[model samples]
Structure formats: structure tokens, C-alpha cells
Target chain A: MTTASENFDTVGLKQSIEGTFRFRKWRSIAVPFAILGYLIYVFFAFDVAGLASRARPENAAVLLGDFWSYKTHITRDNRSGDVVASVEGERKGTYPAGEGPEWVAMGETTAISLYGDASVQYLPENTAVINVPDFGEITTQVNARAVVLRLPDGKDIPEWMSVSRNRVSIDQGNWRFSMTPARTEVFRYQAGWELFFFTLDSPFYGKSVGELIALAIWEPRVTAEHSNIVAMIDGFWNNKMWRHGDVFWAMGETVLMAFIGTMGAGMIAFPLAFFAASNFAPAVWLRLTCRRLFDFLRGVDGLIWTVILSRAFGPGPMTGSLAILLTDTGTFGKTFSEALENIDNKQVEGIQSTGANMIQRMRFGVIPQVLPLILSQLLYYFESNTRSATVIGALVGGGIGLLLTQAIITQKDWEEVCYYMILVVLTVMIMDTISGWIRKKFIKG
Target chain B: MTAHTVSGTAEYLALVRRRRLYGAILVALFFVLFASGFTVAEDRNAGGFLDGLHRIFDFPKEIFAEAFTNWQNLPRLFVAAIPSLIETLNIAAIATLFGGLLGMALAFLSTRGLALWPRLTPVFRRIMDTMRAVPEIVIALVLIFLLGVGPVPAMIAIAFHTAGALGKLFSEAAENVDLKPVEGLASVGGNWFQRIWFGVMPQVAPNWSSYALLRFEINIRASAILGFVGAGGLGYDLKTALQWGQGKYDQVVAIFAILFLTIMIVDHLSDRARQRLVKGGALV
Candidate 1:
């Protein structure tokens, strides 16, 4: 129906349109979808059974702080007729070891205690003979061996609430005691107003059992009245003492590794990049070879590389550093080659016209123009390498991360872990500032 | 006269001699440093490091063959790698979504002559400097303690660090945008946002998208390591296999292949989109 001889002005526009679409049309949609599908397939095919197989690494910091802090015991001494209670390294009021004849102690019948380790301890007594306000107080039968104390409503004490003999001891009271290897027994002891008065001013609140007893023998005033908050603060300070060396060494080692790795990788890749770039290398095979080599290097993650290196080097800083170097070289090489390819060929040609050799052409024609770019690339990679050092340290087992992984799982020492983490963050912040300053000063110039 | 011309040409050639003696000196110094490092490393260690390189070369073929031969044990391998895979994706998603938001916020915040608190340029620069300086891994390691190890902390770490990086690049692109529309908006007394939305954003939007895509590709690689601290991801799978000597090199290779392919495809797409966006503009 159309005239075949008709001149078509749309010819040029049509060819350009078709050409653009040929490369971009189906690709724009299919590529992302294909990637997503591949990711999903990989995800579905992945094995996750080992997610819970390995027991998490223990946090020693948390364990030391939490171990045996919540459970405590109250005991009375039969000979002296004195009674005293200890919870989380702190002792409460003291009474005679046993109940003396014709004496009944009076205080609040109900008492609630908030233990130092963020747990609650309560003693609900049946008799209602003693009463204490705000806190808890109660009185029950005085017996030997182990007797399960009953609540006020005739209910037996909850297992969670049971105070075994191992956790309790009597300072002074009138009572008979039977000794056993396991200290979960109660004794019949009695004490009166004098015992109460003595306990009121005792400094025994925040010392460990051994420390408390030692202090009671040496300095009664200081041992009898310590608080839980102060005890935790003390614990934190003590842990800090042990951590100082590990944290300092780890941070320094990580930073050093990153710096050296970046430098090493940059040096190796600089010359190779010339061959990789099209402008510098006229040989088709050489450019492809260099490009592919660069791809293989950067394609693998540093962590995997670290594992390989560690197995080869036997778990040390050298393996970690090499991992950083190898991984970074691939990345830097790719970028450097790309930059080289983008350089103006005219400059190189100008030098060539002056009968300059290949090396000379590169020195004056290429190096000056790309020097800033190369430095910038190096600086960026250096910043990136600082982070890689941490992961490398964890895998190969050396640095603060060694301590960090152990602390996160074993002890759950969340707070102490917090301290170590703060140090890493601070170190990174400093590195960043320094790198930025250097980049601006040297690279920009 | 002919002799004089030849002598003059020789003098000019010498004057313009391209070899940079200074550059050569610098290169030599670098070589010294490199040599010293290797020497020290070798003395302290042994052939083990070099042997490892040899093993790496031989790993793919040996490992893949073993893995495939015992394909029935694939379930065990899958079980180990699954959680890590989920974690990696989660990190990538979080980083991409939040980083996108942050990039947008920065684009609005930065406009050379129109930014708020012009005096705070150094402050903004310093903050960005700090953020970009701390690598995601470093951030993740620190955060593992604060937030407890899981995927969430790693995601946040990746998002924020990448945001810091992408935001700076976006700001520079925005700064380079055509100022004509801004002038037109200012002439009509339009507010800053109105002017930017109408004038500047259109120009920079495509560049921003391309940059975002590039960052996303990078985030995929970054997220792969989030699991080293028990944050959960593909990195954990790789770490566990390597640690236990599972030798699942085939799986590792497959993953690497996928990741590489993904990045290449994304890059190709971004380039095409950028070219179209820049060229298809309404021309006068």
C-alpha cells in the first residue's frame, strides 16, 4: 500500500534508535530480575542447619560479673546466737546464731530484695512474727538439716525462692548444726537486740565471701556496709584492668595491618594497571589478560582470603595482612586500569611524536595527569583497608577481635564488650580524620 | 647554520626529557619499603604463607570435585550456609533502603550557595570524614557489643557507612548541576526547595540513581562479611566452612561467581541509564 520509492528522512533516526535499544532494551529488565532470581535460588539452596550447631563463643567478661551474684544465704550461729544474711557480696543485718530461749525478734513480716545482679530475692515467711516496712521481713521455724521454708499462706517456698545452705550461713545465734559436704542446711540459732545493733553499722555489703570474711576479720567497719552498685562498679574497674593490654594491642595491630596492606597492594598493582589499560597496552590479549586477572583477585572477599592465608600461615598477623593486600590489589587494580583507559590519548601521542620511548611517554605524558587520581584511589583503599583488618583479625585469630568474639558469646559481658567496641569506633574515627586530611593535602595538591 | 639547528634540537630534547627522576626516586623508595616488609614477614614466618598461596591456586579444582562427589552431604552444607545467606540479603536490603534515604537528605542539604548554616561546612565535612573512614566491618565489630550480634546491627552499620560515602558523591554531583533553572526560580522568588526540585533535582536525579546503583553493588560485597561477628550472613557460611575444613570450595566459587556477575550486570545497566538520562534532556 505504501510507495516503495518514497524517500524516508526517518532512516538515520531509526537506525540510531534501534542500535541503542539493541544493547539496552531487554537487558535493562532481564538483568536485575535474573540477578534477583539467582540470589533467591542461592538463598533457598543454602544450608542453615549449622546456625545453631556451634555453641556461641563465651563472653568471659559477662560470666565473671554474673556468676553466683544473685543467689545468697542467710545463716545463724548457734554458739554466738547471731544471724546475718549475705546477697551478691553484701551482708544484711546480723543476729545470734540461734534463737535464744524466751526471745522473739520483731520486724516487718514481708521483705523484698533487689539483688545486685539484676535479680530479685524474696523470703515470705508463714508465722508473720517479724515485720519490716518497704523491704521484706519474715520469721519461720528454726531447725537443723534442710527445711523448706513455707510462705505465710501455708504455701511451700518456690524452688526459685529456696535458700539452700550452700548460699546461707549464720554469723551468730543459739542453734544445733550438722555439717555436710554440701552447705545447703539450715541451723537452729538465736540472737536478740544486741545482734541487731551490731549488724546495723556493719560494713559487709559488697565484698565477695572470701574478701568479706577477710575484711570482717581485719576491718569490720569497712566489710559490713558495702552496697551492690559500688560492688558492680568495682567489678567493672577490675575487668578493665585485665582488658587494657588486649584492647590496646588489638587496635594498634588492626590499624597497622590495614595501612601496610593498602600500601603493599597499591605497589603491586600500579605497574600492572598500565598493561591492563587500553591506552597503555595496544595488545588485545594483554589487556584482556590483565583485566581478567584483576577480576579474579577482586572477585573473592578478603575473609575467604584470610581463611586461606591463615591455613597457610598458621593463624597470625602475617596471614591477616596478606589477605588485606591480596584483596585490595584486585580492587585497586581494576580502578587504576579503568582510570588509565580513560586518559587522553592525545597527551601520549604528543610525547610519542617527540620520539619518546614507551617508558618516557608514560613518565611525562601519563604519570603527571593520573598521579592525583592514583593517589586518591590509594587513599580510598587505605580507608577501606582499615575496616578489612578487623574481619581478617577475627578469622585468623589475632587482635582485639579475638577478645571480642570470646566476650560476646562466652560470658555475655555486654558492658565490657561495650567498652572494647567504643575503642574500635574511636580508632576508626581517628583514622578517618587523618586519611581525609592527607587526601586533601597531598592528593588534591 | 645546519649544525646550530641540530644542536638546538638536541638541547630542546634534553630540556623536555620525560623521565621523572623524582618519580623514579619515589618508586625506588616504595620498592624498598615493599622489600623490607616481605623480608620481615618471611623471617618471622615460613613457607606456610607461600604454601597457602599454592593451596589457593589448587583449591577450586580440588574442593569442587570433593564437594560434588559427596553431593549427598549437600544438606549439611546448606544448613550451614542458609542463615548466612539470609543475613547477607538483609544487610544489603537495609543498607540500600536507608542509604537511599540518606542520599536524598544530603542532596537536599547540599546546594553550594543555598545550604543551611554555611559556617558548618567543616563540621559536615568532618562528620562525613569520620563516617566514611570507619569501615563497615569496624563499625559492625564495635556494634556487635552494643546491639548484640545479629543481622540488625550489621545492617545498620552497612547502611550508615555506605550512606556517608554515597552522600558525599551525590553532593558533588548536585553541586555540578546546571544553575540556569535555579536562576529562573530565584527570579520568580521561589523558595529553595521549589527551586531545587524544579531546577536542580531533575538534572542530578539520573546521576544520583546511577551512583546509588553503584553503591548497591558495593553493599552486596560489603554485606557478605557481616557474619564474621555472628551477625548472620554468607560470610558466616564461608567462615565456618573454612574453619571446620569443610572444603566447600565449589559453593564458595559459585557464590563468588554470582556476586561478580551481579555487579557487572548492574554496572552495565547504570552506564546505559546514565547515558540516556544525560543525552535525552530537553535541549534548547
Candidate 2:
């Protein structure tokens, strides 16, 4: 009888184990197939096949080029018969009359040098000559009715040059030439940002680092009223092209929004959390009301809060900060209340034994227990909110986000966008490091 | 010994007092900075905070009045917003799915014990860090330029970000997994992929899924925001209706309600799911 019972137990155990393995086997196979099915549906829904035709690879090329290079436009107004050379063709980047980059010689016939020993000369009568080394000179004339083209050595037109009715264009990666009835233009692509340190008007615009250092140490004041060092700083700080002062101010506003928002949320939520915490709540009804209020605030979402606040306060860092404050208050209230509820009862009981009032008991017992958790939460949010502030800043038209969007909208300022992207990333990482350091020193220790 | 104890008490008291003084200074400094920062923010704003604070409810009041008058249209408008809301969710869901898959791969490649190439662990870690640091809006805007205005741009942007963010969380979770199973698998003839898949994945899957669910919540909000910036979803709908102003406010209210309800529902669902996932994780 004992042997038979043991045999029965062994079979039952084996059957149970087999059942579990069968379920696992089914799940392992089913989950992947379900996921694959969903992805296939998304593929069609996103119109990914259509994306191939819609995508602008050319724009990507332009963006990549603009990130590290600047183009100097040498153009002659066909009717006016005058050539002007400007970096990025911005008014602030325009060279003074009769002067241009070293490679560009401004005259009746402007000779602009290009890579590969190529050169473009704007000559008499709405005509331009482009020299392509390893190839021959290609001359194109913009007449009243049509563009007349001549290839070097009677060579067939290369695919790089596209000509249409009354217009002609030559495309080389480093340089480009275009002529219409209105203007004959040659854009000479150069490496690096144009006048990054000093604008066109600054006397110290083209000086090397060694010369700049020498000027700073011993040279006479470049501007009579200010010393060389001051003038140099003035040029850089007030640089119109880069807008260094504005960019720094924007960065400060972004950080400021995060600081005020996170701390302010902590200040407001700390008191409210006590009301919401189940163990600490004076009345059940009060706890429910506080929790519901938090739910409402959180449910409203930061985007909606931002829109509503911007309507009230108008667009700026103030509105952005307020939006962050309201959203974080909800988050902090919920988390802090949970922390309060989880505290050791003995500590609170000990504080109560001293006949301390509610406020004192909370201050002495509850706060001591929860302060580390609260502070760590605040620091984490503060670091994240810095990044959020950029987004909020974009929406409300205030901080680095605004500048980034504006730069992106201009499309030509991809380099500026790249700069702002780097700055934003660096600022976030710095905040992350600082918060980690603080957390280590105070909370962990 | 008594003398030593007495002196030690006094020294400890002195140290405590000095620390309190430093704390007081920090608190005072923080208050000053907060106050000044608010002032600067107010000054830079187009309108004064105090003046605008009183008028805060005016826009909400207008929207409510308009919506009340158009009460009958509310249901239809609500129904109309469902598709865009779905688009928003789709953007988030797709992003979370792709991001989770990429993140899982990246986590395995980066985790110390589970890494396919141990020498290149730091390289993969830095790549993940760089990816995580970039804000979604940056990528969304850049993709908008390349892809034109669509949900695809927002989806891709969010996925790119979700990958990096989830990858970091997943690697951290994977780092703490018991290595015995990994060794057990390797003792047999299991390769690197098999070792990670059979040994490491089961242990970390629960924690990683919980993080991904939380990220899905975040990506939803991100998708909506990206839409407002021209990625095309519920946010774009809200933006257009808001732009129309007075008469169209009923539509705005509908969009807002739909978004709020969706967020609340998602929040509750994900919260419950995470609780279960975590509770079950202990058993696994």
C-alpha cells in the first residue's frame, strides 16, 4: 500500500510540473508573435512605405553641411552691376564695401576661390565664369530671355550643373554658382562658423589666438574708452550673429525655471502631504479631499497647465515655471505622503510621549524620517525639470527651447541649433552630476 | 574616561551648532535665490504675475461658457477626437515597443556580466548616455524637418529617446541579476546570446517591463507635446482649435477632456500593472 501511494504522489508531481512547462512554452511562443503582429500593423498605419517618397534627404545633407560649415555668398545684382560678399548673407555677417574673405577679391570682376583649385569670376554683362580643375572653364551668361551656357573644351554638360529656362546653376559640394535675370551668385563654402568670436564691425574680427593674447596683455586699447580685454569681451558677449549674451541669458532662465519650480513645489507639497498621508491624516474625509486634489492637478497635465498659465501670465519663464510648479506639486504630494505613511511608528510614538504638539511631533519625528526621501525626490525632479523647462520654454517662447525652435525654423541656422543642442545636453548632465553628488553627500551618508 | 566623555559631549554639541548654522545659511540663500529668480522671471514675462494671477480663470471661464452653450456638440466633438487620440497613443505604444526592444538589446550589450563584448561595454554605455541626454523635442524637430509633419516623426523621435532612457534602466536592473544561472548556462555549451537570453533575461524582465510601462506613460505626454510642435496628433488638434479662439472653444474642451481621461486611465492601468509585475517579480 505504501509503495502504491508513493507511486501515485510521484506521478501527480510529474504531471503538475509538466503542466507549468506547457503554459510557459505557450506564452514564450505567443508573446513574440503578438508583438510581431502589432509591429506589422504599425508599419502600415505609420505610412512608412510612403515615407520613402516623402523624406527629404537633400534637407538632411544641407543640415549636416550647415552644422560644421558656413557659406559666403558672392553675388552681383544683374541690373545694378554690383557684387557683395556676405557670410550666410546675413546683414550682420556682410563684409564692408570693397572687402571680403581672403580668398574672395572684390573688384569689377570679383574672383572667388573655391576648393580643388576651382575659382568663380563674376565678369562684365550678367556673365559668370566657373573654373573646374581636371575639367575646363564653364562660362554661363544670363541674357534678357535665356541662360547661355558654354562648357570647357566643348565638353558635354556635367550632371552637377542644372540649367532651365532663363536660369543656370552649378553644384559642387564645396561651392555653387547660380545665375538668373535678377542676380548672379556664387556661394563659396568655408569651414567653421563665420565670425564666431567677432562680428563684421569689430576691429579685432580676423585676429589669430596668439595675436588676440598679445593684444590682451600689452596692446593699446582697441577702443579708446575701453581696454583691449574689455573690448574683446564686449565683441564676443554682444556678438550679433551668435547672440552669446541672449543665449546665456536663455540658459539662465531655463535653470532658474527648474530651480524655482522644483523647490517651490517641494515647499507647497511638504505641508499638503501630511494631510494626504493615511497614517498622519487627522480625518478620513480630509485625506480623500487632498488626494483627489492631487489627482486633479496631475490629471490636468503640464501641457494644459502651461497653456492655461501662459494665457493668464503671458509667455515667459514665469509661466513655464508656474506650470512646472503645479504639476510637480501633485507628484511630490503623492510621493511625500507615501513616504510619510511608511515611517516607523516607534519614532512618532516616542515624540508623542514627550507631550509635543502635532506640529512639533511632525517636525521632530516625521520630517526626520522622510527628509532624505523628500530631498532625493526633489533633486531628481530638479534635474529632470531643467530639461522640461527647455520644452516649456519652447512652448511659452522664453528659454533655450525658444532659441532652438527659432533657429530650427530659420533652417539656415542648423549650426546654431547644433550649438544649443550641445549646451542643453551639457547643462542636463551637469545638473545630473550635481544632484548625484548632493544625494551622495547628504542622503547616502 | 569621565573627562573624555564630558569633552566629547561638548565637542559634539559644538559641531552640531556649527552644522545648524551652515544649514540656516543654505536655507536663507535658497530663499533669496528663489525670490530673486521669480522677480526676474516676472520682469521678463510679457505680463505681470500679480496682475495676471487674478485674471487666471478668465480663459477657463470663457471655455466653459462656450462648451456649456454647445453642450450637444460636445459628444460628437469627443467622438471626433478619438482618432487623433488613438494616433497619440499609437505614437506612444509604437515608441515604447521599438524602444523596449532596442533597449533590451542595448542593455545586454552594455551590462558587465551579460555583455557580448566586454571590452566595448564602456563604449556602449557612453552611447546610451548621449542618447538619453538629448531631449525628445530636439530629435522631434529635426525629424519633422526631414520627414515633414506627421506622427511618424514624433513616433521615431520618442522611440529614439525611449531606447536610451530604457536602456540605462534595464542595464542597471540587469547588473543586479544573480550570476549563478549565467554560469550554469555557460558551464554547458551555451553561447553569449544564449547565456544572456536563458540566464539573465528572466531575472530582469519584470523590472525592465515596469520601467518601460512608466516610460510609456511619459512618451504619451511627449507625443502630445510633439504634436503641438507639428508632429500631428491630438496636440495639433488642440493647437488648431485654440488658434480659432472663441467659437471653436467647444472643440478645445473636447480635446482637453479626451487627453485628461486618457492620461488618467493610462495612469491607473499602468499603476496596477506595475504593482502586479513587481509583486510577481519577487516570486520569479
Each model's TM-score? 0.63, 0.95
Global fold similarity of model 2 (TM-score):
0.95
lDDT of 1: 0.60
Cα interface RMSD of each candidate = 6.3, 0.9
Candidate 1 iRMSD in angstroms: 6.3
DockQ of each: 0.17, 0.79
User: Candidate 2: misplaced stretches above 4 Å?
Assistant: A1-15, A125-127, A142-147, B1-3, B281-284
Looking at model 1, residue B196 earns an lDDT score of 75
lDDT of 2 by residue, A1-445 (tens): 9999999999999999999899889987988899889878878887889998889999999999999999998888898898888999889899888888899888878888889789988889878888999888888887777888988775887889898888889889888889888899988887898888999999899999999999999987788998999999999999999999999999999999999899999999999998999997999999999998888888888999988998999999999999999999999998999998899989888989999998888888888889999889999999889888998899998899999999999887899999999998899888888988999998971
Q: What's the lDDT for residue A413 in model 2?
A: 89
Query: Residue by residue across A1-445, what tens digits does model 1's lDDT show?
Result: 2444343536767888998788677786887798688646544443223323332434333333332222223433333333444322133333333321122232332222222212112222212122223223334333444333334454444333434642322222222122222222232322211221123233332345677555435543432355544543343333322345456667766766776788888888998898898877779899899888877776666756765566557776667778888877888888888888888889889999999997899888988888899887777777666666766676666566666666655543444455566667677777667777988987783
In order, candidate lDDTs are: 0.60, 0.90
Candidate 1 residue runs with Cα over 4 Å from true position: A1-245, A345-355, B1-48, B67-90, B110-130, B133-153, B177-196, B228-233, B236-253, B267-284
- Error (Å) of candidate 2 at residue B199 is 1.5
